[model samples]
Target: MNQDPLQNLRLSHPAHFLALGFGSGLSPVAPGTMGTLVTLPLVWLLAFSGQTGYLLVTLLACVAGVWICGRTARDMGVHDHGAIVWDEVAGMLLTMIAVPVNWLTLLVGFLLFRMLDIFKPWPISYLDKHVHGGAGIMADDILAGVVACGLLHLLIFIGWLPVPAL
Candidate 1:
């Protein structure tokens, strides 16, 4: 008899719960996207805390995610399993840093982050290939977020993407 692959990954486990993006990573399709979407509310909430607070929290999450993701992956006996999406959560948070919290900014940030993450351009692709372990799983997405953040900022600076008055 074959057991379900997810059977061993219990949501009851704190590491599993976090690493899986609070169950968003369990989605049957586009788990990474789902994980990123799940983090939107968090980004919205963090917006109120200002950029410094947002950066601190995102940094903490990324640091903790290394351990949370690594431990969960070890338990599941896989290397950077598709269902481990804490990296996505941290990446999305990084992408939204200092950007306005309005819907347009949120949507643009989401698309930019997701696009870079999916496409893995240049250095992002390099890190994805050369890096290993939990840090490896996270480095690429974080870089994608950084690049996306820069692009978004550029758009705002150029007046291509106007920052709506809050």
Candidate 2:
């Protein structure tokens, strides 16, 4: 693509700032992973308020992300530019829902979410290919989060994944 993802930052658009994960997405390498890493602390902090608070924050983020991502992509004139990583933040937040916020669970959730996102299994792959615009940008990642969440819960149920006392 000829378009520079940084153009919005140069222009100082608020939507670009948020959609870029507050600059984490500007990383030259693995911006999405960087975005998730940046999001971890925010999620950790939110977790202190308990699950209800975490869920509320995550819901708000997801809702805001659709608009932010959409606007940033429009500004960049690119569809789901690699630099727009708010979707990663929302996905990671969704992945962590009810999964406990300890280091181990965070690590597992991150790995699982990244794998499902990268591989894009079945309907996730279908959505990634078929969907468009901001919702499309967010859809596959959200589904990956759902898949990761379910797997984490299953592991907990089987007693394979021990939930550490927070």
Candidate 3:
């Protein structure tokens, strides 16, 4: 019997690619970390589209991703497993909003978002543990995005970051 822990997210499935974070979730080790890294390039490219486009795309992805992730997880028979990383993709996209399309800001946002995501501070942690189904899978990342947005603003306010040119 084949005993791979997370097989439902097949690369052949388009939903899997979107939900598993463009195949980053397929990494044998540290899939969550890999998912975040995989998103950096996409995020960087999207950042060039300006704040409006960035926000719209991220919002759309998040709204659609919940279902894709939920159904894919159910198909794979795993519940919010690390390999299902659409939430990370959507959250990372959200973090790019209103931030400069530069390496420094990307690095900062990536580090901060990943930290909040993994640590699941306060209400974020609460949501992750309590919510069920796709909402549960997506909620924690949404909170992380909120925290990242706040931090990005703070960094800009302190002159540590530059406002993106629309």
Candidate 4:
């Protein structure tokens, strides 16, 4: 079985490329955070088109990520390998759905999403443990994104994080 996933970086398979976050997942440390950071600029650009467009793109990315992550994980003979970070990218996108395109909001969203993803609170933890396959790998982070989204919105609602006027 293929255990060394680093070999995927050399192969030009689209799924591998995407699942690896276009090489951001190669980081020796905190690859998930790196993948999420890599998503910031893309999310910023997507935000230019407004929330509906961003939501549409994020939904599409999540759908595509299921296949990409699953194939990459299968090739590596593992489930949710550390290097498969397309889930992070998709999750970050989902997290920013309600956030305004401000650096502070982005940073806060990043931190919150990372925390929720790592800590795996409540149902997020439950799903992370119980879910299987690509969907399983993606579900926890997606829910993390949801939690982060709620927190960011709550902060905004309470005047803790200012929402820049669009």
TM-score leader? 1
**Tens digit per residue, CA lDDT, model 1, 55-120:** 999999889988898888888878788899999999999898888888988999999999999999
- Candidate with top lDDT is 1
The stretch of ten residues in a row with the least summed lDDT in candidate 1 is: 1-10
TM-score (all chains, Cα) for each model: 0.95, 0.93, 0.91, 0.94
| Candidate 1, position 71, lDDT | 88
lDDT of 1: 0.91
| Error of model 2, residue 1, in angstroms | 11
Q: How does residue 107 of candidate 3 score in lDDT? A: 88
Candidate 4 local lDDT, residue 102: 88
Q: Candidate 1: TM-score?
A: 0.95
Ranking by TM-score: 1, 4, 2, 3
The reply for model 1, stretches above 4 Å from the true place, is 1-5
Better of 1 and 4 by TM-score: 1
lDDT tens string, model 3, 1-166? 8656565457778877788888888788978878888989988888778778878888888898889888888887878878898898888888777777678888888998899998999999999989989888998998898789789879988987875564
Clashes of each: 0, 0, 0, 0
Q: What is the C-alpha RMSD of each candidate to the true structure, in Å?
A: 1.4, 1.7, 2.0, 1.7
Tens digit per residue, CA lDDT, model 2, 26-97: 899999999889988987898898888999988988888889898888878888988899999999999988
